[model samples]
Target chain A: MRTTKVLIVDDEVEFASTLSERLSLRKYDAKAVYCAEDAFAIARSNPPDVVLLDLKIPGMEGTEIGKIIKQFNPAIQIILLTGESENKIISENLGKDISDYIVKPVEIGELTKKIDNAMKEKEKLDHSKGQP
Target chain B: MRIWKKLMVGFGVYVTLAAIIGIFAYVELRTITKRFTVVEVADDITNIILEVRRFEKNFLLYKDDDTFQEIKKYLAVLTDDTDKIRKEIIKEVGTDNYEMMKNAIAEYDFQINILSKNFKLQKEFISKIGVLTRSIEKNLSGDVLNSFLIVRKYEKNLMIYRDKDIYATLINTLNSPKFATAEVNRYRSLINGLFKLYREEQSSIEKIRSKARNIQTFTEDLSKRERANITTILSRSAILLLFAVLTIIILGTAVNIKIANSIATPLKQLEGITKKIATADFSKRIDVRGKDELASLGTAFNQMQDQLQNTMRFLELANEKLRESRAQLVETEKLATLGRFSAGVAHEINNPLAIINEKAGLMKDYIDMSEDFPNKEKFNVMLNAIFDSVRRCSSITHRILGFARKTDITPEAINLNSLVNEVLKFLEKEILYKSIRLELELSEALPVIKSDKIQLQQVFLNIIKNAADAVEEGGLIRISTGIKNNTTFQVSVEDNGYGIPKEMLKNIFEPFFTTKEKGKGTGLGLSISYGIIKKLGGNILVKSEQNKGTTFTVEIPV
Candidate 1:
């Protein structure tokens, strides 16, 4: 079994770092970035298996960052995170390039479960595309 | 005066003047006619005198019995005419002149009678002389016969001419010696007497002629004077009639002009003011005078204008109030739209809450996994408290998001009274805690309406809860439901509580405008309720007085 690499992108530095540390403690390779530039730099330099993106950020929107990351690596799984529980935000970005989403004050167990499912989906796509 | 009366008065004046002129003309005509009658009578008298003179001349020239009878008949006619028209003649001439003319006519008639008698006596004397002369001629010689023939010739001349010289010659011949016999002397005396009678008749005829001349002169003078009087009367009547007509015309014109001005001037003023009124300038008023119809009309017009001005002022005030309300409505709608921003604000706030939650959960995770340490239990409890506080914050944020949420309307049949009761049941604990007396004046006549049941319940709950909150303990809160109007139903929640201050009442429905103490209200309750009612096609109104009470009425269209 391979370790799942998770990238956390949020304007809240403490929330991003603590969530990344929690995910690391749960035995997953996790990293945190505070802005879109750093997020894009880390995504291109070392692509993770799944990216956790906050919908609202300081500079660029989380969805725009997600689309740019997908352009860089089409196989990288993108998951949206939002503090807003509005169904509109979730429904708008659900089926398009993004794999899954979760509301904020993220539960560690539920986030791990969504990441594992996204990694499996990525593996399924990789195997079908003849990549081992 | 009134227009009609004024006109009637003017007409009366004109008619009276016309009548006066007519009467004056009629009287003048009668006077002229009488004058003409007097002149005719005078002329008839003159003609009778002329006829008498003609008969007198005939009698004197022919000495005929028929001529004398004609003279007497004419004299009688003159006398009768003078007598018949005596008063008229006296009126025309003086009484003394009329009497003198009558006496002259009588004297002329008497003289003619005496002349006729004298002529008859003279005729008898001539016949006696003829018989004497014929006897002398038979008994005397040639010389004496010649003298007697001469005396007879002289006597015949004296009788024919009635001259004094012929009478002297006849007397000398009758007294000649050849005629000295008693018969000759007697013939001489008879001839003398015949001559004397002829002279007397001549003098009488002269006297009658002079009397006839006097009658003719007096009658001619009377006729002339009567004619002059008629002419003067005619001229005077003409002047009087002209003056009366002129006076009537001038007076009638003046009166008519005054009446016309009295009527037309006011009418003209009314027309002018009416034109101004047509243009909506009600400032000017008719200057009314008198108790005429036009004055009353002006008063009525002024009253109508006053009413119109009042109505116009009322409309302007109403429009001002409407404008203010519209502005307030726009502000409320703007604040309602602020609910949309509440979603973003909630999202932003949730980030910090999420951070706190994660940090607390991370700390709890570390504490739960780590070995026992000093005050480890306290640290775990504090971390749990932080987590609980973050949860509370998230709940608040979710509530804010609910305001912005576009929830689907699930329309259902709703009975307002049952709904109100249901809402009251939810507030039962609060009501019990406050020991507030609740009175329900629910009407069964309320009809079931189709609306969003949950939203309507939220509106009523917000309003009733606000009512309960506004009151003190043991305060009375009355909840009543009824039909507000033909198309809407109302649920009024009245409370005997400390009412909102006047300044703050206007902003009560504004977003986040709340009088509640800190941490007790989010200030979104009433605003959210307003939004819901507005979406449900209803409205909420609040009436309050400081130290009195507050009433919140929610009206929903049925």
Candidate 2:
């Protein structure tokens, strides 16, 4: 199994820490941040292979944050987390991003599988670049 | 009674004057009549005295003794006549002095008889003296002259007797003696009696003259005094009458003013207040001025009007508040209905969008990784499904936007009867499926009404839906169109179905006041319909009785 780069971004500090620790055992280089600004900082610095974005964030909230980060690198994949059941927040905010969503209180193993799939996607890019 | 009092004074004065004057005049008339009768008696006495004196003159002045004897007979006749005059005079003048005058007259007659006897005896003496002493012619002349002188003396006695009442003189002379000599003493007694009579008569005349003076003086003075008193009384009575009349006039005017002011002032105030209130203004009140019953009555009337105005104001405010509350409630229910609808859309549209998104993302990955592979049918279904979900979402948003729009209608010519017929046609299948018999009494050539067509259609649809829900099998809904006024058209939708309950009737048009089961009716249909109808410059009225039917009448002015 190859190493997978996963970014867990949420304003819940304890939640992000616990989730990142769990992902570490699953062989994912998972990091966490409380805000879109820090997430962007970390993304530009280490550049995570896949971003796990929370829809509600303190600064530059997830919907617009997804757009800005996608503009920076469109090939970089994103999966969204939503705490609210309001369709307006879903359709109006996150609909344009075409990002996949998992309602919160997700299973840890299910998150790990999502990260593995994203890493494979990154690997295909690397192998293609090597062949070229 | 005032007249009685006034006439009382006049009658009293008249009675007093009549009584006093009647007595005074009676006394004066009696006295004057008595005086005249006395004068006539005195004149007769004087005539008898003169006749007696003339008889003595006839006996003495003639030289014949036979003539002298005839004169004595006449003297006796004159004496009886004088005695009758004295009795008649006494009967004529009714006084205590009547007996005095009568006695005096009898004595006068007695003196005349005595004088007549004396003259007869003296004549024989004179004839014998003429025979004794010769110088016959001179002696006859002397005898005639002496007889003439004696007759002249008797004439003087008669004048004195008549002047001083000889009858009274004679009677007084017989009663009191003053003469003293034999023949001369006999003559002296007669002469003394004569002198006494004259003195007594003179005293009586003096007393009568004094009485006449006193009576005349008193009557004349009293007449002047009484006249002055009556004049003063009349003037005083006149002043009192004038004052009484003025007092009556003044009091009458004051009473009239008091009555007019008491009535007219309050009445005028009431008229003004009533006029103001009749125009539906209730800002002013009348002050009750007097504590009289009528003033209290005014207070009560004003209070009643005040209460009526207050009640009217209260009703208007309550009705306005009710309308406002109904609007708020309609808005709330509208939001609630939108929430319920969106919830369904979220569950139905969003989850499918999620599936489409997942499949689309997988498709993109398959295409990216395996360049030679193409799953055409699968990708097409996925893309089509995604497109369809998106389209449904947009349509749902459009429906919500259209339903929630608060567009105000600009009025124009509309055929209300056609609008009603169109709505009924749109709803006829629903009505027929529900088994509600529809009746239409559309008036031909109905005038065009100025109103909102969409709003009218919604109202008709909602009312028909409500009627369909109310009626069981064999129920009827009748729609009638007519002209209400020159500028108004009326449409009535009547249902022979279960009517609204009396208590619920008041809140029928209020939002969320549905009698339908939960989730079947949001209860805002009627409220929104009513609001729309009202906004379109029209009125919707409902008349219903429980268990009988319901009727909705819509009036829209042209």
lDDT of 2 by residue, B225-282 (tens): 3445445555665565566555545654555466556767777888888898999987
RMSD of 2: 18.8
The fnat scores of all predictions, in order, read: 0.61, 0.00
Worst 10 residues of 2 chain B by lDDT: B177-186
> What are the per-residue Cα lDDT tens digits for candidate 1 across B1-558?
877889899999989998888888888888778777767777887887777677777777777899888777776776777787778877767799877887887787788778888878877877776777778889987887877777667766776677888877777766666567888778777876776776677688778778777877887887787778878888888888888888888989999998888788888988887888788787788788888777788789789888988998899999997997787667556655676687778877888888888888788878878999999999988887787667656756776776667545679999988999999999999999999999999998888989888778878888889888988999999999999656889889999999999999999877668898865676777878887777665788889998789999988878
Give per-residue lDDT, candidate 1, residue B447: 88
DockQ score for model 2: 0.02
The number of clashing residue pairs in model 1 is 0
Candidate 1 structure, TM-score to reference: 0.55
TM-score of chain B of 1: 0.59
Mark the regions of model 1 whose C-alpha exceeds 4 Å error after superposition. A1-132, B1-133, B136-251, B262-329, B365-396, B405-419, B443-456, B482-490, B498-510, B530-548, B554-558
lDDT score for candidate 2 against the true structure: 0.61
Q: For candidate 1 chain A, which ten residues in a row score worst on lDDT?
A: A82-91
Q: Please, what are the lDDT tens digits per residue for candidate 1 over residues A33-79?
A: 99999988998899998999988788787788899999987888999
Task: List candidate 2 segments past 4 Å from native.
Answer: A1-132, B1-398, B428-436, B443-446, B465-475, B482-490, B496-527, B539-558
